[model samples]
Target: MRLNPYGEDPVRLATSLTTSPPLTAEELTARCVGAGVVLEQAATADDLAEVNVFLGRWLRVVEASNPQARAALLNELLAESSAYPRLTDHAGDGWHIHYRDYGLPVARLLRALISVGTALHLTGRGMHRLSRCELTECRNPFADFSRGGQQRYCSPTCANRDAVRRHRAKRALAS
Candidate 1:
């Protein structure tokens, strides 16, 4: 069965790219493919540049502190990359939904995927689930898909670091 690609995967891909961006068009294509995005067009140098621009805007949605602000930012992105939704069985994969029409270039595809994926993530989970890591120094964005929706750190290492810091602070205060 084909899984929905418009949820956790795209958000994770966005976070991964934002944290450590792809240095080349080939790298970007590989990263997207690894994230389950099938690129129909060849990734060009200009596509990489355009995608970086989109990523900058996409990160704003992640960094927005309030739901209204996040929604507004996301709406702006949707407006910029808006396309009618359609169903397709491309790649012989079972019928699945796509937010953008077919035959789009790689850069445009990223915009639609990231924007629509983000919308689905926030609406399906909770707007609060998308956030930056709580560790002060590590500002990576993450989409919490855990059962409780209470994730704070981007990774276990950051969580451990924050826990240790908190423990040391408490001990220092007790002394």
Candidate 2:
């Protein structure tokens, strides 16, 4: 069985892009390269602009009101971005499956990767796996890679903060 390239990596990359977005095309290119994504072309200013817009749509998937809404939004992305499965050996790493066509620009490439990756992550894990932090101050979106499927915050810092807050509230109520 082949491990599809569109898996956990893209969703996490999508989360990172949506959370602390790159300010420049070079930065975006650097981030993608850093994340182990093969660059078909170097990102340009236009690519950065396009990706920013695409990320807004991606965030909608994260912020959907319910499971159906979430699936609907993600379906929109999948329909708009991904293509029929294709085979590739990008960088000669070995033959693997790709969901987008060859030689796409950075913006389109990212859209395909993020959309397909998010779908795989949600379907394989749980719909509840993709979510924003529960902490009101920091609503960062995260892909819950937890074993228990009970992630509510974007990070441990936010989780611990909320826990402390809850504990303090309970103590105050007791007092």
lDDT of 1 by residue, 1-175 (tens): 7777776787888888888989999999898888889889778899889989999999899889899999999999988885888888887878889888788888888888889989999999899988989899998888898999999999999999999999999999999
Per-model TM-score versus the true fold: 0.95, 0.96
Q: How many collisions per candidate? A: 0, 0
Residues 1-175, model 2: lDDT tens digits: 6567799999989999988999999999999999989997899999999999999999998988888999999999999999999777777878988999888999999999999999999899998888899999999999999999999999999999999999999999999
Off by over 4 Å in 2: none
CA lDDT of each prediction against the hidden true structure:
0.88, 0.93
Clashing pairs in 1: none
Shift in Å, residue 82, candidate 2: 0.9
Model 1 vs. true fold: TM:
0.95
Q: RMSD (Cα, Å) of candidate 1? A: 1.1
Per-model RMSD to reference:
1.1, 1.2
